[model samples]
Target: MNLKEQLMQDMKEAMKAKQSDRLGTIRQLRSAIKNKEIEARQELDDNGILGVISTAVKQRREAAQMYSDNGRPELAAKEDAELAVLQQYLPAQLSEAEVRDIVAAVIAETGATSMKDMGKVMPQVMAKTKGSADGKIVNQLVRELLAG
Candidate 1:
């Protein structure tokens, strides 16, 4: 089933089961997807839904860090829970070695010789690695490859 349909089904299940937390998280995701659709004036496909999920996960990560710094473990835990829920929709993440290999291939394809070519290399690398690899690790790999 598509993301929106799956979400609606899950929402119904959550309601029946009285899962307030899960229901709230799913509702928030739905709201995010709807807002994006309204803004763009187009319905979101699976890729767009994935983008929305990634953004929600990122926001929760940031909020979790802030909550932890403030000694609010309860709030931090909630954010972690939301992040976990969002991650359920994401594809399996790439391993570090896999990401490195992909970056190397992109660099070679782009004929990127030095750090100066990072801009040229990065777009291709990121397009290949998006949602699969961590951005920081990809950037570090690109930097190493360029420097070497």
Candidate 2:
């Protein structure tokens, strides 16, 4: 099944199982997807929906960290739960070592000799990694590889 279909099925399951947290997270995702569809004036494909899920995941991670740093464990736990729910829809994440290897390969492929080549290197790395890699991690790897 497609991602939207999968999400709908999962939502129904969550409801049936009486998982309030899971249900709420799914509803929020569905609402976000609907808003994006309205804004774009068309149905979002799997890629588009994945993009939305990625954004939600990023937001939740940031919120969780912020809450934790501010000494609000309860709020942080909520964000962590939401993050876990959002992550269920994402591709398996690349490990730091894997991302570093990719960055190295792209640098070699592009003949990127210095930090000045970051503009050329980053986009290609990001394109290759896509949903499997986190942007921040990819960026750090690129900078580390290019600089050294």
Candidate 3:
């Protein structure tokens, strides 16, 4: 089944198990997906769903960091819990070494010998690594590769 179908099934299971935390996270995700659909005026495919999930995960992570910085561990923990729930739907993340290797390959493929080539190389690398790697990590790797 597709991501949306999988999410719906999980939501149902959460309801049956009376998992309020899981249920709440799922409902929030569903709401976000619905909002995007309404705003974009189109049905979201798996990649589009993933984009929404990634955005939600990023928002929660930022919120958690902010809460922790403001001395609110309880609130931070809640955000962390929501992040974990959202993360389950994300594709497995690439390790640092793997990301570095991919960045190296992109650099080689694009002949990006200097930092100026970053813009040229990043889009190709991101296209290849989308959903499998984090953009920030990939960007850092690219900078290191170009700097070296």
Considering every candidate listed, which one attains the maximal TM-score? 2
Give each model's clash number. 0, 0, 0
Mind giving the per-residue lDDT tens digits that candidate 1 earns over 14-84? 99999999999999999999999999899999988988887888799999999999999999999999888
Candidate 2 structure quality by residue, lDDT tens digits, 66-121: 99999999999999999999898999999999999899999999999999999999
**TM-score of predicted structure 1:** 0.91
- lDDT: the better of candidates 1 and 3: 3
Candidates sorted by TM-score, best first: 2, 3, 1
* TM-score attained by model 3: 0.93
Tens-digit per-residue lDDT, 1-148, candidate 3:
9999999999999999999999999999999999999999999999989989988988998999999999999999999999999999999998999888888998888888999999988999888777777777888988999999
lDDT for position 34 in model 3: 94
Select the stronger candidate by TM-score from 1 and 2: 2
Ordered list by lDDT, greatest first = 2, 3, 1
- Residue 20, candidate 1: C-alpha displacement in angstroms: 1.0
lDDT of each: 0.89, 0.93, 0.92
